[model samples]
Target: MNSYIRVSLAVLLVALAPVHSLFHPGVNTITPDAPKLRSLGAQQGILRSVAGSQNLKSQDSLRLKGGVTSILKSLKDALFPVETWEMPKFFSMSAMMFMIIYIYTTVRDTKDTLVVSTCGAESITFLKVYGVLPAATMFMLYYSRISNIFSKKALFYVTALPFMAFYAVFAYFIYPNREILHPPIPQDLDERWKYAVSLLSNWSYSLFYVVSELWGSVGVSVLFWQLANDIIPVWQANRFYPLFGQLANIAPICAGQTVAYFAHLSDKGDDAFGVALQQTTVLILAAGACFMLLYHYICVLGERD
Candidate 1:
């Protein structure tokens, strides 16, 4: 029965993956018209408020009050605060994790959009097999090596700083000069050469996709949780872990909406890609910095106490 319960919990966690994926398609399709959607929602809300004020029957009002009450009750249960000084720590850690996960999902979704736009379906299939699997293998090997050399706190920097630098360089240099770096296709190339060229042409996008894939493993699955476990006591974890898990489940929704909002603000012309990349780069850096600062602060507090 204990083993069965463990398997059931694991399955429940795996099921949440689809919830995050559902946010991606909306970002890809609706981003172009995000402003219009927001406006429409606002108009509907206003109309509903006006109608309610003018002609709300007692039955309708009762139903509305019941719905609102139920929503408030659910919110209270989901976000119930701990009665301790560690409440700030719990909230800060939760917020930091949420930001890290949000950055990962948003960037991953954006990278997917670029990959599909630049390469296509077959390229995605090739990336899943040839690109990501090999990168994952190499990363694990390197990570294992460094685990012996560096403390866990230092290991976080060893992994994260390089990624941040690469992103900065890619956003500022490679992406903007992509066309210059990879010129138009020549008519004289052989068929096999042409296929190779097609894949090589999207080199930066492919690299972005690979790095984004690794971010989840390095940032969220490893570093963030490791830090959490190091700080939060087991008894406190029993109370806050479920709330943190719930916050994590809500993060992808917030991330998707943020991506859509930014995409809506993006320029309509050739500068759109650059603008989007720059914006996401800022967000990625900010999330990493904030997470590290909070991690350090929490550790200091833990040590002092």
Candidate 2:
């Protein structure tokens, strides 16, 4: 089995290398800005005029608040709704959930994944897929008192509730119009069931449906990766991050495949179901972040026990 796997990988790499090379010939062969090429004919002249017109549109801007005092006032007003009202409610709910079960699950799941799959033969073993740097660090650090400081239950409830309430108030008022939450649908139901069984499911519309559904998930995933760089630690991350991150990158692909299958079963167009699936994931992540903050507090408090 091992020999066959190695042979297969070798063949796959050989097949892809030439294809990659042929498609991306070097930049040196490319011509510079084509000044002469711009005046091909009347059509080219019109194209250039339109391009110049569009370029002018790019220069427009708002020159509001010429000084620091006005800027400061603007900032305060922008933040006021969240700071005054929404932050409090969010934190209140967060704290309640934290007192119930936030950090416990995180720690438990981490331990389970680590202990169960350490250095296994599985194609995507937890350690190999996730890397050893962080996992090893987490195991080592887990025994340290400093790392455990935030692991207590009592400390969690004390620290979690107040900050969460505060953050929640701000979060709520910050974007009062934003509706981020969406509940999940039944797991067994497929989206395609609607089209498979219904006469009104237009084939041409399916193309638009699929494209719109994918654009959001993909576009947002790209945005989140940009967001992650600002907050994710460079070092000691392997030691700190949970085991599930090993499969995190592949998750979207797996999810797309799974949901596509479900859509086929449901008779709903694949695109429609894909959109719903991605929206459902976004809702879960938002809720999970709130819950995780509370859990952190509980873990700190539990250490006292």
Candidate 3:
């Protein structure tokens, strides 16, 4: 009986392999050559970048495009004269690698791990359904009434758009500014008090990262799900949910390919323009999503039987 159960489990695992791979961070389609392009561009003092490369009008210049090789190659060029971009790219890659490994290990250990994954899901749904969304809706509605705010739909777009625009701008600007914020802590702490102070400081930074990640994940997840329910019919939820979720996965796949394609393109002098193009594309997507959601809600309200 135990052997039969093991065989059945093994078959189930095989059946689910493709679905599991879809979400696996390590299973990226982006090639390893992308970093090489960034490094080369760095060596040439050409400001190596997928975005930069994509901007070049010259047909000879490398164009960052969708592929594994293109991404690493682009990064290789981006490294430039002083080899400065390498460290940041390394750190980013390391974090990604660690996340992939950690998630893989956790999934494997789920059989013996006492983690209440379902309980956490329930807690999230409970909070969003009962507490968070309700509070947010009330707050927004109240503010809307007092301010005679434009349609809730307009407010949603207004809130979402500025945040997105800010994020893109911040990524380009404030992201680099982080290096300035991270000063080296004094290691000359011979005293216990100094050590305690250093420990507290480190803890504070760690706490900030944890809070940021948690808030970002929760906010996006809640917004997407709420948007889904608003747009998708209750009867079609099961069918459309899977489809939409798969569509969302397209971002990572596309990012990977873009990273590759842009690597070569950037080498040919197209990075800046490519970056602008991508940013414009994202903005358009956000606008379309917001419009659909608003339209759906309007339809729901108008259909009074």
Candidate 4:
């Protein structure tokens, strides 16, 4: 049926061609509609050209649209690179990881400022062996006991809140009172005993250093990774982890800018370290809180699924 229809249409078009040309006016021949026919052909040509340009324009638009789509898909693959269903958990977990590392960098920097500025650089080596080691051991025992008692979510706060509180007080209170809090050691004391005395003298700074170190070791290495291992499936853990790890570089850039800005603003003053410590402490607390919120959100997402 379709073949017959095509043959009939072809025959009709062929038969009409001569009939249509019979109305044409040649250069020597004159007709009432010669001008009209010439004008009509010209108009037809104009219409044909306009339609062809319009087709080209539409094709160009489609090509541009496809290019934009391809670029967007590439960005999505680079950034998230997770399945559509995985996006919620992936985004939440990755953001939380970024926030954790950001705050940790700020805290570690601040801790160094507190210890080295007050007790000198040599004090750090002594403080870690004498100070951080014992504290880590005690924290390990406490963590074991609490692990049995508190829920995982509650344990996060239990572990983090003290670190956060110490950060607040050390910067605002203890650091300001270092003269009274840290005692003076005699000039002639033995080298080995001198650092021990300094560690004892500047107990607050030592404690700050210890807590900050543990926060890095325990708060992140143990708490966060453990949670991540549980929440993310082993099959997919390979996918989005690296993306967020690189994303963490963003934190250091912002942190470096903040430190430089504070240093610049306070360079002339005797309180240069003081100013940087306070600013970074504020940033650490803020990032820590954001991380807590993000963790809770990710946990909720996990439960929902």
What Cα-based lDDT does every candidate model obtain?
0.80, 0.38, 0.43, 0.81
TM per candidate comes to: 0.69, 0.19, 0.33, 0.74
TM-score for model 3? 0.33
Q: Candidate 4 vs. truth: CA RMSD?
A: 10.7
Model 2 per-residue lDDT tens digits across residues 137-204: 54335434333575333433433343334323322432232223212223354554422322112211
* Model 3: CA > 4 A from native: 1-155, 176-181, 189-220, 260-305
Clashing pairs in 1: none
What tens-digit string does per-residue lDDT give for candidate 3 at 1-305?
A: 99999999999988877777678845534446757776786877665565566666443443433454777767765532113533332222223222222222222222111112212222333334444455556545654574465664554455445434543444355434434644555767665444334433333232222222332343344334444455446654544444443344444444444444544455555344335334433543454455445444444543531
What value does the lDDT take at residue 34 in candidate 4? 72
Q: In candidate 1, what are the lDDT values of residues 93-209, reduced to their tens digit?
A: 888788788878887887898888877756777787778899999999999999999997788889788778878888889889898886665668785555455556778888888
For candidate 4, the clash count comes to 0
Ranking by lDDT: 4, 1, 3, 2
Kindly list the per-residue Cα lDDT of model 4 for residues 137-206, writing each as its tens digit: 9999999999999998999889888888988998899888878877787788887687788778778877
Instruction: Assess candidate 2 and give its TM-score to the true structure.
Output: 0.19
Given candidate 3, what's the lDDT at residue 12?
A: 90
CA RMSD of all predictions: 34.2, 36.9, 37.1, 10.7
